[model samples]
Target: MLSPKKIRHRKTFKGRMKGVANRGATLEFGDYGIKVLTCGWITSRQIEAARVAMTRHVKRGGKVWIRIFPDKPITKKAQETRMGKGKGSVEYWVAVVRPGRILFELGGADDELSMGALSRAVAKLPLPCRIVKREEL
Candidate 1:
């Protein structure tokens, strides 16, 4: 799982995740990428799982880039614990993913292999995603 090695804070409030992604919407380091279609919290484990799937599918054909990181910390009190006992500990980390955000990118791979790899990555993600090709400008 991808996590920050050091952090200034341990616990944080659940913030809002609205509107489309303004940053990281276009492909930067790859010819093909995966664009999300919905807004949600993408866990670190999910991101790693998707990356593993893509790498395994593509083999040695391409270079993969992960555009998102789970910087936000999610807290859980405990299993069946009583409420009102202050905030819980940091349980996991997540990335706030909005529509149009590119989560994964592939460079140097053929069209078929890259697409297949990205599709396999998509299946591992909880959010609905579509593969996007870079448009020459």
Candidate 2:
């Protein structure tokens, strides 16, 4: 799982997802990309899984760029514990993803290879996503 080397804060409040992503909405590093179509918290585990799938599918023929980082800490209390005892410890990290955010980009691969790899990656993600090209931006 992805985590910060050193975090200033251990726990944080659940923030709201207000709008579509304005930044990182376009592909900057690759000709093919995966665009997030829904707002949700993407866990580091999921990200890694998707990355592995993509790389394996592409046979390492292309370069991949992960646009989002799992920097936000998510806390969870012990099961069956009391309701109130301050916040729980940080359990995992997540990236707050919004609609229009480009999560992954692939370069150096042909159209067919990129599409196959990206589609495999999409299956590993929790939210619905669509494959896009740099020209589509």
Candidate 3:
């Protein structure tokens, strides 16, 4: 379980995700994962790194949770197109970054690129967010 402060940080850091799903895929909680607690914005390149790492360990499976503020605003044409005008209400996102695959459990953003919170959240996780092979698990 995450501490409340960490949970809050996670919400603040999840600003860059798309939206949320009740229970989507079998890969809900990644086999290997990182839970982040943040407040500021992150970059695409950083997210890409985590994604790349996750991909390398695809067999093991991994997920990155980024938490952010709920009422913060997002200003991107792409976001408007994907999430509409009244979105961005949630507080975090779950991004699974794999080399050949990047799965995003968006909280309240538009496109995956805008998910800075996801990137930051991934950075905060204690362990490296690399997906290991089934053999390791």
Candidate 4:
């Protein structure tokens, strides 16, 4: 699992996802990319799993860039616990993703290879995504 080395605050208020991604919406680092199509919380473990799948599929033929990082800490209460003891302990880290966000980028590989690797990565993610190319950006 991926987590911040240091956190200024352990608990934070729940924020709203109100708009589409404005920045990092285009493929900048690679010729092919995976663009997220839904809004959701992407866990750190899921990101690592996707990365491993892509790396194994690429087999050193390309470079992959992970655009999102799990920085937000989510809290959860213990089962059978009372409901009034503040919020809850931080349970895990997640990246809040919105529609139109480019989650991963692949470079140095041919179209077929990149697409295959990206598709494998997509299976590890929790939300729906699309494989895109630089020209499509």
Clashes of each: 0, 0, 22, 0
Q: State the RMSD for candidate 3.
A: 15.1
Q: For candidate 1, write residues 32-126 as lDDT tens digits.
A: 99999999999999999999999998899899999999999999889899889899989999999999999999999999999899998999999
The model with the greatest lDDT is 1
Best by TM-score: 1
Q: For model 4, where is the 10-residue window of minimal lDDT? A: 128-137
Write one digit per residue (lDDT tens) for candidate 3, span 20-128.
Answer: 3223222333332232222233334344555554444332333344222223222334443665564345432333322222133332232232244345445644333
* lDDT for model 4: 0.93
Segments in model 4 whose C-alpha atoms lie over 4 Å from true places:
none
Give me the runs in candidate 3 sitting further than 4 Å from their true place. 1-27, 58-137
lDDT of 4 by residue, 8-116 (tens): 9989888988789998899889998899998999999999999999999999899999999999999999889998969989898999999999999999999889999
Query: 1-137 in candidate 2: lDDT tens per residue?
Result: 67789888778889999799999999899999999999999999999999999999889699999999999999999889999989888888999999999999999999999999999999999999999987762
Lowest summed lDDT window (length 10), candidate 2: 128-137
Regions of candidate 1 where Cα sits further than 4 Å from its true position: none
Query: Candidate 2, 71: how far from true, in Å?
Result: 0.8
| lDDT (C-alpha) at residue 37 in model 1 | 96
> Any idea what lDDT model 1 has?
0.94
Give the higher-TM-score candidate: 2 or 4.
Answer: 2
TM-score of 1: 0.95
What C-alpha RMSD separates each model from the true structure?
1.1, 1.5, 15.1, 1.6
